[model samples]
Target: MSTENYPVVFGTEDILRSLCDSVSRVLSVTTQSQIRYSGMVQRISKTCLKPDIGCFVLFDGGFSGLVVINFSAPAAMELYEQYMLNMGMSKDELTTSHTSDEVSNVMGELMNQSVGDFTAKVARELQTHITQNQPKMMALSKQVILSVDTHLEKPEARRVTFFTGRNNIFYLELAIDRTEFIKLNDFDASEVPDPDALMDQVHGATAARPAPAVSGTSEHDELLNSLGM
Candidate 1:
């Protein structure tokens, strides 16, 4: 078979499961909240992007990826209240008058710690060292689509929601390009002839087309079957 015929297969389910486990652990420890895995969403859409405040942390190693945790304003305020209460602050002292700077600082610290825990989990699963960029807050005013490769399938993404208590819900999103994802998992590339060259060729050929706006596991599975993986 030609070198180009080699199949590429990725286990997105396994990746999302691992991430869900990691987030559950981190949130439970830091926020003293009970977390339950809700469900997974295949695409980044307006419904899922409803949260206005979010913190994003970048992961870099064999592959580049991001871990984003989003919170509604009310949810953010609730989390802040819970955190302060945990720190021995009296409920009487807790007030809504706290400036954005104060709320953002606490949120940023929690996000930083959460990302640290997540990277540690990823390192164990991938058996490779993982480095993360500083976590930062972002406001989503409109819908945003992910970058995809025309030569390959769209990136795999899953959103896992965790219900704490009293209707407090928070979510984490994991999206990774299929090609880089395989690499991050330490897939064997020995059989491929010039893997880097092959990737360059494929990317060059698919450079002109725009990435797909929607994604699903079924679509990715179809692509995998077509590749004979």
Candidate 2:
């Protein structure tokens, strides 16, 4: 059978799914907690930053888009606490309020990692590159509607619900140009590389390498004698 006959189409929802996977994967690993998203997605006209913690990142290159994650106060604190605890920090040393700059910084960092993973997958799976700007995070008291500064032709927006290990709810919003990628031929998408496995391989190779020969007094004497000194 000709492969072209069964062309696979990748569209807006597909891209949103990839971004959601990256979010879940990165957060799950970082905080050692179960992070998941709802299977059903909401089609929205625009993306916004909602209280209590709002974060957004813009990306361009292969495709331009904006990613917004609105975390409730409880959701923000839960993730921040879990991430810090995972890093060996005691609960007493943690901040209790999500309004703290530290909490915003941590959330922003996680958002950055999530988008980074998404972009990497896009490069590997879609065979195209995208560049993301630094994530901007704010502790909002009210909802603020924001749009991407860059013009997106035929823009499409989506919102997905996410839950942390503690069942704290948050929302993820994505706005991108309406685009589709039709597969022309069959190819396997590359898997994400494991950092721990890569480090183990490096250490194993280093251990297997033979040490360089060291010069001793006997060898020095042998050299001197060979020189007729």
Candidate 3:
């Protein structure tokens, strides 16, 4: 008989942290921003309501789910400004505040990268393939109320919040059918590298890098850190 790899089973918490890690990676590479997880909730609570903007990305494969990101007004504005600047727009070009269309577009692109990263991370974690749908952005006057698919037990959903280096807070919600998530579990311990081994690899690589000029290295690092790099 032919054999096939199975998807890894992950708890709601594992999924939330992986998504958060994906967000952090996207922010770091795209916006040069840093983020840390703030909190998580297992259901659609009031806190997940009334977001200024939202982006939804669907996933397929053995691990089917939805990732919905909601940005607060301040968080949206901050990200928009930085994203525009990174796109080479001048401050003068940004004299006016961002409109709904602009915010939606920028956030759509951001979430697209984030969810793409999430899928990659999930694939590595699960040691199985996963597919993602194109991200869809929604501009809303208030939060959306998603209808539950009765055919599938109430989706195992969670709200995960993260704080940016600039102290801005934004959150994303993850929803996967409970049965699907459980079915996907086929965890392989060997797929995950040892933490100590990874740390040694990092240290070894860092040790091989040439020393920076003492006078300017700190200043340069400070500048990048200020930009949340």
C-alpha positional error of residue 76 in candidate 2 after TM-score superposition, expressed in Å: 0.3
- The CA lDDT of each predicted structure is 0.64, 0.91, 0.70
Q: State the lDDT of candidate 2 residue by residue for 147-168, as single tens digits.
A: 5453688889999999999899
lDDT, model 2, position 10: 78
- Model 1 lDDT per residue over 1-229, tens place: 3434433432666666766777667656666877567765556522233445677767766555667777766667777777888888888877673336666677778877777765665565555567877877654444742332212235556677767644677677776655423332344433435689999999988996787877556877998989999
How close is every model to the real structure, measured as TM-score? 0.61, 0.79, 0.66
lDDT tens digits by residue: candidate 3, 1-229: 3223545357667777878888877876676667677754657632233446667777877667777777777777778777788889886776344346777788788888888877777766656577987877765565364432323345677787777768988777777766424343445634756799999999999999999766746777999989999
Error of 3 at 103 (Å): 2.1
Error of 2 at 16 (Å): 0.6
Candidate 3 ranges with C-alpha deviation above 4 Å: 1-9, 39-42, 45-49, 142-151, 179-229
Cα RMSD, each candidate: 21.7, 6.3, 17.7
Best by lDDT: 2
Ranking by lDDT: 2, 3, 1
Which residue pairs show backbone clashes in model 1? none
Best by TM-score, which number? 2
